[model samples]
Each structure stands twice: as structure tokens, then as C-alpha cells.
Target chain A: MMSFSLIVGFFLLWEILCIALNVSDLILPRPSEIIVTLVTRFPVLWPHILQTLYSTLTGFVLGVIIGVSIGVLIGTSRVAYGVAYPLLVGFSSIPKVAVVPIFVLWFGSGTTPAILTAMVICVFPIVVNIATGLATTEPDLEDVLKTLGASKREILWNVGLPRTMPYFFASLKVAITLSFVGAVLSETVASNRGIGNVMMTASSNFQVSLVFAGLIVLALMGVALYAFFSFLESRVTGWATRGNDIAIT
Target chain B: MSMTSDISAPARPTAALQPATQPASRSNPVHPRPAIELQDASVVFGSGDKVVTALSPTTLRMARGDFLALVGPSGCGKSTILRLASNLIQPSSGIVLLGGREPAAKELRIGMAFQNPTMLPWLTIEKNVMLPLKIVEPFKRTFQQDKKGAYRDRVHALLAQVGLQDFAGHFPWQLSGGMLQRANLCRALIHDPDLLLLDEPFGALDQFTREELWQILQDLYLDRKPTVLLVTHDLREAGFLARRICVMSARPGRIISDKAVTMPQPRDIGVIYTPAFVEMTQGLRELIAQIRK
Candidate 1:
């Protein structure tokens, strides 16, 4: 309820400031104007919204799978970590937008470039977080399991993976957001679908309110995905935080 | 249940008694195979100029069901012996065997507990105790079928022995240090391993709590009869729990003295106050003190 009121107050303030300043619609559209445009353009914008959502979701899911796989590889083996870490760091440093054009060059625009961009951009955070989680598994705990004749695979399954949940979930939140950025960035540069493409066209046509509407939609989607991952994190890793209640008391 | 009553000593005295007459020795030719045999085992860490010998060449043996305590000052490699026995680390030199064979070659069931309870925070105490059954063989093959039946009963019985029966559903974080350590003991014993290794398992508890756990551990030992290797600094603890105590010298540690506790078996915490117990502990203390110098 508190967060709901805070959101309302923020929009109300934005609305009041636009009216009081008598700002031109082209310069900065009011929250009311953006909402009006979003509602009026709903029919025309619906396909674009669906396209962006589909691409982003596809990219996000693919990115997570690849990221977690690489993360586990680096986490469990010192040789893999040593060989892959520097290469991953170097790749992650390259501007993802620069890589989108190369993806476009290969995939020839449309949804493929956007999906590939999203997948590549979000993989780094997931890998780093997963490796860290695996590396941090308690040696004493491992030894207890080892002396029971637990094979390496058994130790990983019972202790290593469950212990990695908190770190994995934290990375998901960040990775999900980055996935959206990659998808939208790719769409604006190379595609004729998605919110990014729609916003680009609206801005060019001086349909400022429509562009503002697209921004709001993207923000809402980003928030929704982040909240989804946060829910999962709490469900799977509740043990990590629930212990604090006893400590505080 | 109240903690004291829950962990009260058993009514039967004979359960705790071993023959009391037969002392253990490396040269006990009558025994076909010692449960654990370290033939001149040594451990050295690092290399070149940074070299440090953690354990000097040492020979030791324990017959089946022997409870031996390794005691000395800090860094005397008492823990190294436990690690070697458990096969967590191989000796840098010499042979380390279980039942007269290399540890890896045998399907030896082993259980170990450290000073830190090290419970996985995610699991309830009951599930934490059952971890070994899910991984160790024979148990692992039938674990799914027996999880709700025989395995559950075994876990409950072990928990009841340590006064943690009521806290089986609780997570490790909800329990006190003493309670968690008791659960740790339960986890170690749940697999009914052939070997049990404990490293300062009660050293962190308060004096009263520590004494209470000693009795709890005593009860468990009497019931299971696994070969036990305990590493502790407290001589009284050694005297109360071990059939024999081995004292070692500092740094590149080697066994300087080995003495058997010939007192009557299955002794209670009260035995720590007896003249015989005091004399045995004092003798070990002086041996350690002399070696330290």
C-alpha cells in the first residue's frame, strides 16, 4: 500500500509540474498525455507490444540457460575457470550495441538479432554470480559429505547446487533487466517491430506522447520481470534470509 | 523434554563396559586386522623455503571398535591423524590403511564431526542428519523406498539419544551451539559408519554443556560401537571418553606417549572427578607439557 501511494504521488507530481509549467507536448509530454496516447494507440501498438515481449522473454530464457551452464562449468573446475574467465571478462566489456550490428549482419535483422543480442548481453552476470556461489560452498561441509564416500557429482548435487540458489537468483534479477536492454537496443537499430522500433518511428514523426508511452511500457515490463524473479528467489532461498529473524531477536 | 533429562545416562552399566583388561597396542598380534593403521604416516605442507612438516612420521593402530584420543598443544597434528584416517588427505609419506587395506580400495563407511556443527542451513535437522543415507551406498540404493520408514526411525532414534528429538524439524540457525553440535553428532552417526572421527567436537561448549554432551556421546558410542578417533585438547575429556590417549609433540608432531585408560568402562561424567581419572589426566598433561618444552 505504501509503494502504491508513492507511485501515485510521483505521477501526480509529474502531471502537476507539466500543467503548471505549460510545457509544450513536443518538449516533454505529461503523464496524462502519455497515458491518453497509450490508451488511444492501444490497437495500433498492441502488435508491437507483443513482439517486444516475445523477443525479450525468449532472449532472457536463453541467456539464463547458457549463463548457468557456463557458471557451473567455471565453478566446478579450476581449469575451466582459468581458461574461460579472462575471455568472458573481455567479451563482456565490448559495447553490446556494437555487437548487435554484427548479429544483424549475420542473422539479417528481424527477431533473431534482437534475441541473440539479449542472450549474449545477460550471460556475463549469470556466469560470474554462479561461479562465485559454487566457489563459496563451505569446505567443511564438503569434507563431511566426502568422507561418507560421496562422489564429486553427489557432493555438487546435494550441497553445491542448493547453496548456489541465492547467488543465482540475485544474478537473475540483474540479468533479466539487461536482457530487456539488449532486446530493445537491438530492435531500435535493426528491426521494424517491438517497442524500440515503435518509439523510434514515433520520435521521428514528432509524435512525442507516443514515444513517451513506449518508454512507460518498457519500464512496466522491466519491473514485472524483475518482480517475477524476486518472487522465485524468495521461494527457493527463503532459508538464507529467514535465519536473520532469529539473529535479530 | 528438558535438556538434562533428554540426555541422561543410560540405566544399564554393562552397555558402556569393554573388557577393561585388554589394552590396545600396535603389536597386538592376536588381532587379524586393526580398524585403522597408520604405518609411519607423515604430512608436510608447502614446498621449497616455505616447507612446514605438519606431522612427523608416526605409527598408530586401532583395533575394531577402539576409541582413541589424540591430544596435544595447538598445531601438534592431532587433526591431521583424523584427516588421514578419514582419507580426506593422504599422508605425504608412508601408508595409511583401513582394516589392513588402502582406504580407497575398501568400501569403508565413515562418519566425522568437527568443532563447527557445519549443518546445511537449508535443511531441517532431520533431513540434515539423513544426508549420508542419500549418498552412501546400500543406503542410497534403497533410500527412496526407506526414507519414510527405517531411515526416518534411525534418525529419530539418534536425535532422541542427543536430546534433539523435539528439534528435528528446526533449522540449524534456530538452535543453540550445544544443540547444533548434538545434531552434528546425530548426522555423523546416522549412517552407522564403521569409523567415526571427531575433532574437538565439544571444545566450543560451556563447561556444563560440554560435560552433558560427553555423556550423550558416551551413550551413542556404547550403542553403535564404531572405531572412534577423537582429537581434543582437554585431558579430562580424553580420559573420560577414550580407551587410550596419545600425546604428541609440537610442530612436526609425533606421538611422544601413548597411555591406556584401564579404568572401568562406560564411565559417567562423575568419573572425571575420580582419583584414577585425575591421575590419568594429570599424567597426560605432564607428558604434553614436557614435550612442549
Candidate 2:
């Protein structure tokens, strides 16, 4: 309730500042104008919003699957970690925007390139988080399992996988937003659909209110997915983080 | 000293009478074998210039069902004995055997508990106790096929032994440290291993909690009778629980003394104040003090 009111107050202040400065619509549209554009352009904007959502969702899911697999593999084996970690770091360091052109050339300016870009951009964090989770198994706990004659595979399945869940869920919250950024970046550069493309077309035509409208829609989608994953994290991995609650109380 | 013995005199007569009937049980052809044997086994960590000897050709043996404690000052390589016995680390020299032979992969049957409870936080207490059954087999192979819920019953029974029957559905995080430690004990013993290894399993608990766990552990040991090897620095704890106490020297640790504890079974907390128990602790404490110097 408090956050909602604060956000409303901030937008009201922005509108007042715009009017007081006599800002032109071409330079900066009022929040009121953006809302009006959002409502009036809903029919035209809905398809673009749906397209971005579809591409981002597809890319995020694929990224999680591939990233978790690679993370587990690298986390469990020293040789694999040593061989793959540096390569992963170097690959992730390269700005994902730079790869948009290559993806567009290969996949030809559609949802495919957007999805591949999102997947590429979103996978690194999941892999890093899952790998860190697996790598940090308590040595005492490992000893307890080892003495029971558990094979490495058994330990990984029974203990390592469950241990990595909180980290995996945390990465989802971060990666979901990155997936949106990736999809939008690819769309603005090459795609003919999605909110990114709509924003690009609107800005070029000086429909600044529509551009702001697209950004609002993108942020709403990001927040919805972030809240969804946060809910899942609390429910599924509550035990891993319940210690913090005890400390706070 | 006579006054101390006078207080314990009544307990001894009954204890002496009870052992006479034990020979009949011993005469049975199913004689107990040595549970763990470390024959001149030495461990050295690292190699070349960085090499550090942890245990120096330590030879030790425990009769099946014996409760033995290893006590020494810090950095005395007491834990190396546990690591070697569990096959977690190979000894640099000599042989370490379990149940009269080199432990084969399938024959690896040992239960271990450590100072930290190490419970899987995601699992309920019942599930945590049942974890070993899913890994070590013959249970492992048939765990999925047990439609009768026999494994669940076994876990429940083990949890009941530790008085955690009511908390079986609770996750580890909800339980107190002492409760988690009890669950840790249940997890260790659920598979019915031939040997139980404890590395200061109650070290982290408070004095009162530690004493309470000592009784629980003693009851469980008496009930199951698995050969136990406990490594601890607490001499009083050693005297109270173990049938034999082995004192190790400083680094490159070797057994300096292995003394038999002749105190009878089902001993009480009151026994610690008895002159004989105090004498045993004093002797071991002196040995450790000398090694420290």
C-alpha cells in the first residue's frame, strides 16, 4: 500500500514539473499523456506486448534448462570447472548487444533472433549461481554422506540439487529481467514486432507518449515475472533462507 | 578415596553379579570379530616440501560392539583416524581394514555423525533420517519397490528412538540445535551400519545439552551395539561413555596410551564423580598435558 502511494506521488510530481517548466510533448510527454496513449493505443500495442512476452518467456525457459545442466556439470567436477569457468567469464563479459547483429544475420530479424539473444544474455547468471551453490556444499555434510558409502551421483542428486534450488530461484528473478532486455535489444535492432519495435517506430515518428507507453508495459511485465519467481522462491526454498527471518525477529 | 568408593559400592555388587551370566552369551559360536583395525597406518598430507605427517604409523583395533574414544590436544591428528577408517582418505603407510578385510565398494557400511548436525534443511526430520536408505543398499536397490511403506516405518521407528516421533514432519530449520543433533544420530544409524564413527558429535551443544545427549547416545549404543569410534578432547566425556580411551601425542599423532575402562554398563551421570572415573580422567588429562608441553 505504501509503495503504491509513493509511486503515484512520484508520477504526480513529474507531471507538475513538466507543466511548470512548460515542457513540449516532443521533448518529454507528461505521465498523463503516456497513460492516455497507453489506453488509446491498447489495441495496436497488445500484439507487440504479446510478441515480446512470448520471446522472453521462451528464451528464459531454455536458458534455465541449459544453464542449470552446465552449472551442475561444472560444479561437480574440478576438471570441468577449471576448463569451463574462464571461458564462461570471457563470454559473459562481451556486451550481449554486440551479438544482436550476428543473431539477426543468422536467424533473419524475427522472434528467433530475439529469443536466442535473450537466452544468450540470461544464461550466465544462472550458471554462475547454480555452480556456486553446488561448489559450496558443507565439507562436514559431505563427509557424513561419504561415510554412508554414497556415490558421487547419489550425493549430487540427493543433496546438491536441493541445495542449489535457492540459488537457481534467485537467478530466475535476475535472469527474467535480463531476458526482457535481450529480447528488446534484438527487437529494436532487427525485429519488426515486439514492444521494442513499437517503441523504435514511435520514437522515429515523434510519438514520444507511445514510446513511454511501451516502456511502462515492459516494466509491468518484468515486475509481474519478478514477483512470480519471488513467490516461488519463498515457497520452495524457504528453509534455506528462514535463518534470516529468525535473525531479524 | 574410601568415601568415594563407599558411595559406589552398592552399584558394584549388582554389576559384578551381572557379568557372570555374560560368558554364556560369549560362548556362542557367533563370536564378535574386530570391527576396525588400523595396523601401522600412517597418513601424510601433501608431498615433497609441504608434506605434513598427520598420523604416525598408528595401530589400533576395536572389538565389535566396543565403544572407544580418542582424546588428544588440538592438531593431534585424532580426526585422521576417523578419515582413514571411513576410507575418506587413504593412509600413506600400512593397512586400514573394516570387519577383518579391506573394505570393498559394496561392503562399505559405516555410519558417521559430526559436531555439526549437517541435516539437509529441505527435508523433514523423517526424510532426513531416511536419506541413507536411499543411497546405501540393499535398501537402495529396493527402496522404490517397497510398496508396503516398510522404509517409512523403519525411519519412524528410528525417529521414535530419539524421541523425535512428533517432529518427524518438521523441517530441520524448525528444530533446535539439540533436536537437530538427535536427528543427525538417527540419520547415521538408520542403515544399521556395522560401525558408527563420531567426531565430537556433541561438541557444539551446551553443557546441559551435551550431558543430555550423552545419555541418549548411551541408550542408543546399548540398544544397537554397533562398534563405535568417538573422537573427542573431553576427557570426562571419554571416561563416561567409552569402554576404552586412546590418548594420542602431538602432531604426527601416535597412540601414547590405550587404557581399558572397566566400569560396568548402564552407568549413571553420577558415576563421573566416583573416584575411579575421576582417576581415569585425571590420568588421561595428565597424558594430554605432557604431550602439549
Candidate 3:
């Protein structure tokens, strides 16, 4: 309740500050004007919103699959970790925006470039988090399973994977937001679709409210997906953060 | 962490006691083999200057249905012995065998509990207790069918015996330390393993809670006679629970003294106060003190 009220107060403050300062729409559009643009342009904007959402989801899913596979390899094997970790670190440090044009050059401007960008941008965090989760598994737990005569595969399935849920979900929230950034970056660089493309066209035409409207849409999508992932994290890993109704043994 | 050791029990009415001898007949053909044997088995962690001898040239054996306790000061490799028997680590030298085969033999089923309750946090106490049934054989083969019928009932019965029947649906975190340890024992016994290895399972509990768990353990042992190898620090605990107690020295640990507990079976918690029991623990403590020097 407090956070909801604080957010409302923040927007109210922004609206008052803009109107009192008499800021030009081109210089800074009011939240009221942006909200009006969002409502008025909903019909024209729907397809672009769908386009960004589709590309981001596709890329995010692909990133997670590849990340988990590499993570298991790196987490379980010393050689793989030593070899891949440096390369991954270097790749992740590079500005993802710089890579978007190269993706466009290869894919020739459209959803493919946006998707490839999102996939590459989001993969690093998932890989790092999953590997950390797998590597930090309790040795005592492993010994318990080993004494049960459980096969390596069985131990990995029963213990290693479940133990990694918290780390996996944490990375998903981070990577989901990054996926949006990547998709939009690629759309702005080359594609003629998505909210990023809409913003670019609006700004060039000096449709400041439409540009602000695009930003609002992106912010809303980011918050919505982040909320979705938080819900998922709670459902899957509720045990990790269960209410302190009883003291731990 | 399979928390719960064999060392803490000092309870049970002597009336229900049975002789530790007279091996119960199992279904196996041919002569029965000792459940575990370590011949000159030694473990050295790391190599070169970093090499620390965890156990030095130790030979130990346990017959089927034997309840043996290994006791010593901290760093005495008592836990290493348990780990060796469980095949969690290979000895740096010599032989370790379970049922006359290598300790890692596929057919061998072992149950283990440590000093820390190692229940998977994601699973409810009931599911955690039933973990072995999903892995070990015969039961593993028909687990889905049996889980709903005989297997589920067995878990409930064990839970009821340990006074945890109502908490079956609860997670491990909902229980206290003592309660989780009871559930730990149920998990260890659920699959009817041939060997049950316990490493200081009660080492973390209060004196009162530890004694209460002793009775639960005593009942479990009398009902199901799996060969047990317990590693613990408390001599009274060692004396109370096992038919035999082996005391080891400090680091580079090796069993220096092996003594048989003469107290009759199903000893009550009062046994810890009896003259004979007190004398026995005193003697074991003195032996350990002498060897430490």
C-alpha cells in the first residue's frame, strides 16, 4: 500500500512540476500527454507491441536453454569452467548496442536481428547464475546421495537441479529485462517494427508525445514481465524464503 | 547433511532387550559375510607437504546386524571411517569392502545420517523421508504403485513411531532440531538399507532432546537390525547405543582401543547413571585421554 501511494505521489509531483515550469512538449512531454498519446495510439501501436514481445520471448527462451546447458558443463567440469569463463566474461563486457548493427548487417533488418540481439545479450547472466547454483551445491548432500548408491545423473537430477532454482529465477529476472533492452536496441538500429522503431520515427517527426508514449509502453512491459518472473520465483522457490513461522532446525 | 549421529542415545527399558548375538537369518543363500571390512585402509588428504593423514592403516570389520560405535577426540578420523564404509571417499591405501565386495558395489544399499539435518528444503518431510524409495532398488522398480499403497503406509507408521505423523506435510524448516533428527532417522530406515552409517547425528542437540532421540533410535534398531557403524565423540553415547565401542587417538587417527559393552540390550536412559555404564564410559574416556598424549 505504501509503495502504490508513493508511485502515485511521484507521478503527481512530476505532472505538477512540468505544468508549473511551462516546459515545451518537445523539450519534455507531461505524463498526462504521454498517457493520452498511449490511449489514442493503441490501435496503431498494438502490432509493434506484439512484435517486441514476440521477439523478446523467443530470444529469452533460447538464451535460457543454451545458458543452462553451458552452465551445467562449466559447473560440473573444471576444464570447461576454466576455458569458457574468461571468454564469456569478455563477451558480456562488450557493449551489446554496438553488436546490434552487425546483427542487422547479417540478418538484413527485421525480427531476426532483434531476436538474435536479445538472445546474445541475455545469455551471459543465465550462464553465470546457473553455474554458480550448480557449483555451490552442498557437499554433504552429495555424500548422502552417493551413499545411497545414486548414480551421478540421479544426483544431478534430484539435488543439483532443484538446488539451482533460486539462482535460475534470479537470473531470469535480470535477463528478461536485458532481453527487452537487446530487442529494442536492435529495432532502433535497423528494424522498422517494435516500440523502438515507433519511438525513432516519432522523434524524427517531432511527435514528442508519441516518443514519450513509446517509452511508457516499454517501461510498463518491463515492470509487467519483472512482476511475472517474481511471481514465478516465489512459486518455484518458496521454500527458500518461506515465512518465519517456525525457527529452522 | 543427514544430521543425526548414533552417539546420543541413552534410553530404553532393559526388559525388551534382546541379545546382540544370534544373527537373524536373512534370505541370502550361503554363509553370511561381514557387512563391512576395512583392511589396512588409510586415507590421506591432498599430496606432498599438504598431506594430512586422516586415518592411518586401519583395519575394522562389522558382522551382519552388529552395532559398532567409533569414538574419539575431534580430528580423530572417526568420520573418515564412516565415509570409507559409505564409499563417499576412497582410501589412499588398502582395501575397503561392503558385503565382501568393493564398498562401491552397485547392489549395496546404504543409509546415512550426519550431525546436521540434511533434508532437502524443497521437499516436505514426507517426501524427504521417501527419497530413498525413489532411488534404491526393488522399491524403485515399483515405486509409483507401491508409493500409494504399502510404501506410503510404512512412512506414516515410521512417522507415527517418531511422533511426527502430523508433521508429514510440513517442510523441514517447520520442525525443531530434535524433530528433524527424528525425521532424519525415518529417512535412513525407510528403504531398509543393509548398512546404516551415522556420523554424530545428535552432536548438535541439547542434552534432553538427545536422550529422547536415543529411545527412538533404540526402537528402530531393535525392530530393524541393519548393521550400524556410528561415529561419535561422546563416550556415554557410544556406550549406550552400541554393542561394541572403538576409541581412536587424535590426528592420524587409528583405533587404539576396542571394547565390548557388557550392558544388556534396550538399556533405559537410566543406564547412563548405572555403576557399570558409568564405569565403562569412564574407562573409555581415560583410554582416549591416555592415547591423546
Candidate 4:
């Protein structure tokens, strides 16, 4: 309740400042004007929001699947970790925005480039987090399982995977935000549909309030997706964070 | 590393003379096989210039259903002995046999509990205790198909034995350290293993909790007489629990002494204060002191 009021307070202060200055709407729109644009331009904004959402979600899901698989492969074997880690680090270091042009050249301006960008951008963190989680299984715990004649596969399935849950979920929260960033960056560069394109078109047309509205919708979607994953993290891997008790019941 | 006394070479003559007095039942005609045996087994970690001999060639044997404790200073490779018996690590030299056969060839079931209490945090106490059943075979083959709740009933009964029945639904992190250790014990024993290996299983607990767990371990051992090998530094704990205690020398570790405790079974915690128990522990303490020096 306190946080919600503080956010509202900040917006109100901004609105008051905008009105008192009698700022040009083109230069900086009031919060009320942005809200009005959001309400009135809902139909115009809806399709772009959906396009961005579709690209982000599809890319995010695919990224996670491939990331987890590769992470496990590297995590389970020292040889694989040695072989792949440097390569992954190098790949992740290349600014993903630089790849957007290459993606645009290949797929042209549509959802494909945005999605491919999101997948390429978002996969690194998931892979690193999951691999670290698996690699860090306590030696004593491994000894305990090994003494029972548990095969490596069994140990991986029973202990390694469960131990990786907290890391995997943590990466999901990070990856979701990155996915949005990737989608938006690609859309701005080469795509014709998503909120990024909408914002770009609106700014060019001098519809500053509508551009702000596009940003607000994107922020709202990011927050909602982040919150959903956070909820899922607490639910599915609660044991990992059990003693922390930072989350409200 | 500084070289310690070659304890095994010096102690061999004494060890050979002593085994004759290790009770007739151990050599009884009907049951000739020792539960676990390490014959001249040595473990050397790494190779070339970095090579470190963890356990010197050591031979030891435990009779079926015997409770033996290996007590030594830290890094004396007492744990290596347990690991060798469990086949978790292969001996660099010589043979380690369980039930008079190579460990790999034998259908040996081993239950092990460690100092950390190593309960999987994700699993509820009940599920954690039931873990061995889901892994070790014959049980693994039928655990899911036994839809009659037999496995669950067994888990509940085991939890009840450890005074953790109420916490069966609780996650490991929700439980206190002592409670988690008790759950660890239940998990180790759940499969009804032929041999039980404990590596400082109660070393982490406070004095009161450790003593309480000693009683729990004693009762469990009495109820189901499984051959037990416990590795610990606590002489009093060794005196109170094991029928036989093997004291090892410092690293490049080898058994220096294997003394039998004649204090009798179902011995109470009060036994630690008795003259005989004190003598036993005192003997071990002096031996360790000499080795450390």
C-alpha cells in the first residue's frame, strides 16, 4: 500500500510540474495527458502490444528450453563445461543489438527478427545460472548419493535438477525482462509492428503523449510478466528460499 | 608433508596376535564371512609429484552385525576407509571386500549418514526418508507399483522411531539441526542396508543432542543388528557406541590399534563415566596423542 501510494504521488507531482510550467505537449506531456492518450488510443495501441507480447513470450520460452538443455550438458561434465564456457562467454559479450541488423537482413521486417533477437539475447543468463547451480552440488551430498550405487543419470535427475530449480527460476525473472528489451530494440531497428515501432512512428508524427502511452503499456506488460514469474518462483521452488522469508505470505 | 611413523608395519605383529582374541562368534563355523574387509588396501590421491597417500596399506575386518568405530585425528583417512567399503572410491592398492567378495560384484546394500545430515531441501521429511526406497532396487522396481501405501507406512514408522512423525510434512529447512540429523538417520536406515556407514554423523550436534542421538542410534542398532562402521574423532562417542574401536595414525593413515570394548550391549550414556569406558577412551586418547606428536 505504501509503495503504491508513493508511485501515485510521484506521478501526481510530475503532473503538477508539467501544468505549472505549461510545458509544450510535444516536448513533454503531462501524466494526465499520457493517461488520456492511453485510454483513447487503446484500440490503436492494442495490436502493437500483442505483437511485442507474442514475440517476447515465444522467444522467451524457446530460449529457456534450449538454454536449460545446454546448461545441463555443460553442467554434468567437466569436459563440456571447459569446451563450451569460453565460447558462451564470448557469444554473450557481443552486444545483442548488433545482431538485430543481421537478423533483419535474414528475416526482413516482421516478428521474426524481434523474436530471434529476444531468444539470442535472453539465453545466456539462463545457461550460466543453471550450469552454476548444477556444478555447485556439495561434494558430501554427491558422496551420499554415490554410495547408494546411484548412477550418474539418477543423481542428475534426482538431486542435480531439483538443486537447480532456484537458479533456473531466478534466471527466468532476469530473462523475461531481457526478452522485452530485445524485442523492443529489434522492433525499433527493423520491425513494423510491436510497441517499439508504434513508439517510433508516434514520435515521428509528433504524438508525444501516444509515444509515452506506448512506453507505459510496455512497462505494465514487463511488470506483469515479472510478477507472474516471481509468483511461480516462490510456488515451485519455495524450498530453495525457505529461510529467507523476504517474500510476503 | 612430514612423514609420520609407519604405524601399519610396526603394528602388524600386534594386530595379528590380537585378532585371535576377537571372540569365537566372529570365527564361528556357521558364519565364516566378515561383513566388511579391507586387506592391505591403500588410497593414494593424485599422481606423479602431487601424489598424496591418504590411507597406507591397511587391513581390517568387521564381523557380521558388529558395531566398529574408527577414531583418529582429522585428515587421518578414517573417511577413506568408509568410502572404500562403500565402493565410492577404489583403493589404489590391495582389495576391499564386502561380504567376502569384491564390493562391485556383491549385492551389497549400504546405508550411510554423514556429519552434514545432507537432507535434500526440496523434499519433505517423509519424502526424504523414502528416497533410498526409490533408488535401491527390488524396492525401486516396486516402489511406485506398491499402491497399497506400504512404503509410506514404513516411512512414517521410521519417522516415528526418530520422533519426527509430526514433521513428516515439513521441509528440511523448517526443522532444527537435530531434527534434520534424525531425518538423515531415518533416510540412511530406510532401505534396511546390510552395512551402515556413519562418518561423524553426530559430530555437528551439541553435547545434549549428540548424546540423545547416540541413544537413538543404539536403539536402532539393537532393533536391527546391521554391521555398522562409524568414523568419528570423539573417543567418548566411540566408547559409548562401538563394540570395537580402531584407532588410526595421522595422515598416510593406518590402523595403529584395534581394541575391543567389553562394556556390554544396550549400554547407557552413563557408561561413559564408568571405569571400563574411561579406560577404553583413555587408551584411544593416548594413542591419538602419540600419533599426533
Q: Which tens-of-lDDT digit does each residue in B1-293 have in candidate 3?
A: 12244434554343322333333224234426678878899999998799899999998867777789899989989999999988889999999989889976654679999999899999999989998998888788988888878888989998999999999999999999999999999999999988889999999999988888877887789899888998988887888799878889888999877666667777677778756666677777888888778
Q: What is the TM-score of each candidate against the true structure?
A: 0.94, 0.92, 0.93, 0.92
- Docking verdict class for candidate 4: medium
Off by over 4 Å in 1: A243-249, B1-31
CA displacement after TM-score superposition, residue A37 of candidate 1 (Å): 1.6
Model 4 chain B scores worst on lDDT over the 10 consecutive residues at B9-18
Candidate 2 CAPRI-style tier: medium
Estimate, for each residue in B94-165, the C-alpha lDDT of model 4 and write its tens digit. Answer: 999898888887456899999999998898989889888988876899988652399999999989988998
Model 3: lDDT to the true structure? 0.87
Best by TM-score: 1
Query: Candidate 1's residue-wise lDDT over A1-249, tens digit each?
Result: 678899999999989999999989999999988999999998999999889888888998999999999999999999999999999999999999899989998999999999999999999999999999999999998998888878999999899999999999999999999999999999999999999999999999999999999999999999999999988888899898984555321
DockQ of each: 0.83, 0.77, 0.77, 0.70
Please provide the root mean square deviation of candidate 2 (C-alpha atoms, Å): 4.2
- Per-prediction interface RMSD? 0.9, 1.3, 0.9, 1.0
The digit string of per-residue lDDT tens for model 2 on A16-107 reads 99999999999899999999999999999999999999999999999999999999999999999999999999999999999999998887
Q: All candidates' lDDT scores?
A: 0.88, 0.85, 0.87, 0.87
DockQ of 3: 0.77
Candidate 4 residue-wise lDDT, A3-50, digit = tens: 799999999999999889889999989999999999998998899999
Better of 2 and 3 by TM-score: 3
Residue-level error in angstroms, candidate 2, position A38:
1.7
